[model samples]
Target: MRIYKVGGAVRDRLLGKPVTDIDWVVVGTTTEEMLAKGFRPVGADFPVFLHPKSGEEYALARTERKSGRGYGGFTFHASPEVTLEEDLIRRDLTINAMAEDDQQNLTDPYHGQRDLEARVLRHVSPAFAEDPLRVLRVARFAARYAELGFNVAPETLELMRQLSESGELEALTAERSWKEISRALMEDQPQVFLEVLRACGALRVLMPEVDALFGVPQPEAHHPEIDTGVHTLSVLEQAARHEQPLTVRWACLLHDLGKGLTPEEEWPRHIAHEFNGLKLIKAVNERFKAPRDCQELALLVGEYHTHGHRALELKPSTLLELLQSFDVYRRPQRFEEFIAACEMDARGRKGLEQRSYPQADYLRGAATAARSVAVQPLLEKGFKGPELGEAIKRERLKALKVYKEST
Candidate 1:
């Protein structure tokens, strides 16, 4: 059993990044041989084994063929005849293609180390386009490494463009697409992914709902022609600036996706846009195979504006009741995230110079205050059954009245 450290672990170590996961490549080893040696078999399409003690994954060195399209269109071969160099050559990026032996000997036939030093994201070979999933992976990598000044190779970008144009992107499952997008959103600079996707024409094909937002003018009150896409990007940037959780960031990035489907005539006054966006957000969640909590957060962001606007007029009891309607504990960070989304959206308006109301500051301060007051004894009286519920309800109403009178 020749064990060689491979992929992200080696790349991250070279880049001085934290290594969270480790993958091993076993050359000249069969799955049956691995099983006999006490490794637990795992992979179905590919031959991967789990170490009985460490639990780290060890995959047999293999090569793939694109028998279909999208993520599921591939067949893997892990026979002893498969060479380590051939396995590395089939990887999407050069930086991820390099491997290191148990004794720390390096094997980099693709010059992945050179690209890593230069901060470039180059394909392992011209054959990178064989797997359509590589396009999304490259775009995601661009987002993650934007701070390092990494740029995708021109040839690689061209192949991505070709794959996107050839409808290979459409073959990708929503879950696969979401996985790439989710990682991109979690990056410090997610706009890089969007920019790369736009350049490659993949954004429009893969997420046409979002692509439709480009250049769609907002009300004259919005400066810089803030379309849905621009607004979404702005929200994402704001979320990143605040260093919010991943779910919040994703919600902000996709908050206004439904605005594109709204009629052009209602551009700025999209009163029902939140509801519309929620449907699209749910569809996206299902497509991407997001967890239930994540879906809730995304949907919450989609309807954040409505909730914030309603909060302004709600009594304390009504507000608490409304807040209690959600599984807030399961997503403890959502309140802050909702506020962040609202703040970004409000600030991006065009006619801020002409507006009559203090919408931005009001939304910010109100959301903040609501969060603070909702934790008070009156709001959290620990009531359970009918009597407890009634008492809590009474306290909430009284509190709301006092708040309204003070305002």
Candidate 2:
């Protein structure tokens, strides 16, 4: 059996980037033979094994034909006759279809190297449309390589549009879609992923709320971008630029869903949109099965992000209510992430990318002030049971009042 390094390992190496993991494709190998050689079987749908020493995945060279719908609908053929070229051709992108031999000889049957040099993201074959997941994968690759000036080939994007319209994208399971969406959200240019998806008509299929934001108007004074959709992407981009965590990024993406529901008669004004968007954020969170932390943070940011922006102007009692809503006493990091998401929204305007967000510091100070109130003092004063709870709340409010006055 001949084993060759394949997929992202070879692609990243060719781009002069770091390779985090290595995938091996083995040709001329049988399941029985692989089992006899000490590789542990792992692949449920196909013949894939884990190396006994390195623990890296080594999948047998195989070919698959579409047998049903969605990404999992496929029948695979793996045998001694299955060639490495056949396996490589089934990859989603040309740049990901190259392989390297033990001698470090690169094989480019699909001209992946050429596309790499050209800085284009092209499909390996028409089979690209067979799997709906490729649409997200291509968009993700676009996001990852956007800073490198790489773009999806026009023809490939056309195929993506076709796939988006074919009703196939809807067949993809939400969990699988979330896997791609969350990963793209963490990429260097997360907004590009959404943009490419929108360009190829997939955004409406995948994230209709976000897609609806396009063409929707916003107050030009506050959002120089004017288009709510453009501003949403700008906020997501700001989340990535600040190297914010995934929860914050996810919050940035969904925080403006209510704005999309604004009545056109109202034009640029979306009063009480935060409350209007709470349900939409919950819908998105449930749709993707986002992590509990991510869901909680998204909801908090969606409903109270305006409160974050109005931090300095809020009454002390209101400030304490906001802090209590975040449960900041026990989970301060989530509070910090919430503030970061709000800051991203504030900075996502057309010409305000570098503008200061004093709201963040003000909110942090309020949280600190509330936390500074000692519960031990109330205990010493004979405050007990539910009365102690009231006393602690009163003291915290007093501290926040002092902080507000000082600010």
- lDDT of each candidate versus the true structure: 0.75, 0.94
Candidate 2, residue 215: how far the Cα is off, in Å: 0.9
- Per-model TM-score on C-alpha atoms: 0.82, 0.99
The number of residue pairs in model 1 that clash at the backbone is 5
Tens-digit per-residue lDDT, 200-310, candidate 1: 899888777778778776655444555767776766765666576777776776778777887777766666777788877877677678777678777886875656645
Off by over 4 Å in 1: 220-225, 265-271, 306-334, 344-395
RMSD, one per candidate, in order: 4.7, 0.9
Report the lDDT tens digits of candidate 2 across residue range 1-407.
99999999999999999999999999997999999999999958879999989999999999999999998989999999999899999999999999999898999999999999999999999999999999999999999999999999999999999999999998998899999999999999999999999999999988898898999998888889999999999999999999999999999999999988999998889999999999989988888889999999999999999999888889999998999999899999999999999999999999899999999899999999998988887899999999998999999999998998898
Q: Evaluate model 1: give its lDDT.
A: 0.75
- Model 1 per-residue lDDT at 69: 69
